[model samples]
Target: MRRPRAETRWAYVFLLPWLIGLVVFQAGPMVASLVLSFTDYDLIDSPRFAGLGNYAKMAQDPKVARAVGNTVLYTLSHVPLAIVLALALALVLNRVTGRAAGVFRTIFYLPSMTPYVAVGVLFLFLLNGQAGMVNQFLGLFGVQGPQWTTDPDWVLPGIVLMSLWNLGSTTIILFAALRNVPKELTEAAMIDGAGPWQRLRAVTLPMISSALFFVVIINTITSLQMFDQVYTMFFGNQIAQQSSGDAALFYVVYLFQQGFQFLHMGYASALAWLLFAVIAVITLVQVRVGRRLVYYEAEEHAG
Candidate 1:
């Protein structure tokens, strides 16, 4: 007990930098933003108290509804597709080993490491309606592709497709999870006359449920917070004017426009807080649901 005090002191010493950084950089900004959410403050002028005015204005703001709708739609479309694709890639990669696995892993992960700005720019040409690679490939099969950037019906789907480029991290995580499943359990299941599908359904999925849960939450968050690619591709200086109406006006994008372009810092902060609230509620619900779904080997061990 006496020695624990000295050990705890050293632990705190080691943790001091991280604690300081969290308070200074993260917690500080969050608190400041919270306060700013209730006040009017352009970058030029001092903050003026507005109480719930900024938030109340959001109720009547048509753009807020549009932004939220677009974001939710994108999240719905992107999160499941990303997870399924990542899981599929992981399952394929899980069967391989040695140098071949390493090469494939690197190849899949390289696209994710590419900057979103570059991805956005590259995709512009790839998704172009007139003479893009994707259209050319589709044309080979007697199918014509839609104008990805211009048409309202196809614009959001294009964004969702673009979002898949960064599923490499999710794939790697699921791959690691798949590799961690106990071979003995699988072998036992096989001995019991379980077919490939049965064994996978009963053993593999439950074993990796925790990872799937994690990927779902993370991908959902990423989908909701999508900004970089959208901005770089559709909302840029020379491109925004050509965008097909409100199909791509995600919540964060609208927040950026309000805060920077229109100088509505208070309104932007309010929007940020609203998004935070939404994410918090959704995460809480997911956690509640996941508690029953996620299989924990540790819990079984402890029992």
Candidate 2:
């Protein structure tokens, strides 16, 4: 069946604004960047056609390797911790109901709404070595804290801790997914003498596996793009030099330095496209594995 021409025209008319915005905002800049990636443009004069020079330079750049390693390490450290903590919060939130549930949910979510710059500053203060709040707390237990901001060994871990401060959104998402699980399934498992751990393993987790998968993918991308917190806390700070700034030199931050700080516009564009490709490939792999692991209610019904 086909819609009437007048109705179809109205639908397109309603979508016109968004379509125009996409062409102008998203597609246009992407095309321009793609063209720029093949040239040598330093934000002044004409873009010299350099062919594959930018990519070749990127391939041989040691900073690029360091940035990629730091990003991967951060992602590994943060993603699992975020997923576990978020799921734990979701489980706790799942046990509450009514007004109390809403209050707790709002409390858990507020941190995610905090400005990244402020969060970075707060974390820097808290994680400071000698007299900061975190070390001060640790000192109560007769432990001396490492210099998180000035020591290379602890700096990356400290940044990971900072990133975990904004897990409210992930918790809320997992909490919603947990809520959607049918109570009947868990009750049946309980009736069969399944313990709390057994029920969680057999029923709760499988039911929420899709949400876990989503959180993993989203966290991977977000971790890869971490910049504002790092820049706010480390970039230009003298302590960062002592801390081995390479440990915090994440991919997106390096790209920003190239494009804006050093004015390597063309090289930055190439790096941007390479990052895009890496993300796309990784997402594809996750989706491939997810097909085997994710339990879909619709698929069960269809089968």
Candidate 3:
């Protein structure tokens, strides 16, 4: 006990820099932002307390509603598709062996490592309506691809499709989870005359449920906060124009325009807080759901 306690004290000493950095950076900004949420302040002017006035304006702001709607739609379209695709790829890769599998894994993962700006630019070129690869391919079948980024109807779908390029990390995580699943348990299930689907449902899924939960939560949070790709592809050079119409105005993009462009700092702070509340609630709900569905081997061992 004495030795462990001494080691624990040493651990704290080693962790001091990180703990201090968190307080100075993350916690400090969060508290400042919360305080700013109640105050009306342009960057130049002194902050004046507005209480809940900024938050109250949210209900009346049609643009806020539009941005939120766009964000929700994007999140709904992207998250499930990404998860399903990643899992399917992982399952396929898990069945392969040796150098060929390694080559394929590296090939798939390279896209995720590519810079977001480069990916956005690549997608824009590929999805362009006139001379783009996608439209040209569609023309071969007597069809036409929509102007992906320009047309409001197709912009969200284009963004979602672009987002899939980075599913490599998710695939790698699920692949690791699949590998960690006990082969003995699978063999036992097979010996009991379980079919492929039955074995997957009974043994495979439950064992990897924790990893699935983790991926879902992470993807949910990421999808909700999406901004960079939308900006890079649509709004990067057009800050003054506020172009891209209703389809491209994601929640974070709107918040950026408010705080920086329009200089509505107070309202922007309120929007940030609202986003935080939404993320917190969704994460809490997911955790509660996960408790019922996620199988933790540590819990089994403890029991």
Candidate 4:
């Protein structure tokens, strides 16, 4: 039987605001950016159609390559570490209960709510080269700490360290997943002579695989777009100096410079599209690979 027209009309009425926002704000700009990527628009002048010229330039751009390399390195360094740390925190918290667990959970999550700019500035002071708190602490043990913000070799690591502070959100998600996992499986595994590590590997991991997959995907996307922390800590308002800013010039940072600072709107649009393509491909690969690993409890019940 066909649904009544009046009811169908009311559903569309309720969805109108979202539909309008999607078209006007999200989908509209995506389409416009794709078209603009083929042109040479400097925001002031008219966009002259340059066909594939922008893409050809990107192919030979050394800075583009550097930016992409930096982004990939940052993603690799931060994502896996963040996931592991978050999962470990979740596991620890899973064993706790009552008022103490609530207090601990809030303490852990508080850092995630701190503004990125504030955290960046705070870390710059903490990780200072000579007079910083970090180096001073290291000096107590006679270990000289490297210049975190200024040195190229240590800048990425510094950023990764800051990234760890935001693991509260990931930990909460994984903690919920751990709670949902069937305890009977782990109990049975223990009864069969499985040790703690073996039970964790065989039972707990498979049960929470879906949550693990979600964390991996989310972290990958966020790490690739890391800009605010680097901007505040390394490049805000100051002239770009090779010793300090070069190491922190991430893909989004470069794109921001090209679009707003340099006024190369067309080139920036191309960069945006290229990043979009990369993200699309990575997400697709994750979904493909996830098919073999991520387990759904509903599917098990159905089987």
State which candidate has the highest lDDT: 2
Per model, state how many residue pairs clash.
0, 0, 0, 0
My TM-score estimates for the predictions, one after another, are 0.95, 0.97, 0.92, 0.96
Q: Rank order by TM-score, top first?
A: 2, 4, 1, 3
Task: Please give the distance, in angstroms, between residue 53's alpha carbon in candidate 4 and its true position after superposition.
Answer: 0.9
Q: Which portions of model 4 show Cα errors greater than 4 Å?
A: 1-4, 237-242
CA displacement after TM-score superposition, residue 237 of candidate 2 (Å): 2.7
Q: Worst 10-residue stretch by lDDT in candidate 4?
A: 237-246
* Residue pairs in candidate 1 whose N, alpha carbon or C atoms collide under 3 angstroms: none
Off by over 4 Å in 1: 1-4
* Candidate 4 displacement at residue 142 in angstroms: 2.2
What's the residue-level lDDT of 241 in candidate 2? 56
lDDT of 2 at 226: 91
> Which has the better lDDT: candidate 1, or candidate 2?
2
List model 2 lDDT by residue over 54-146, tens digit each.
999988999999999999999999999999999999999999988999999999999999999999889889988877898999899999998
Report model 1's TM-score to 2 decimal places.
0.95
TM-score of 4: 0.96
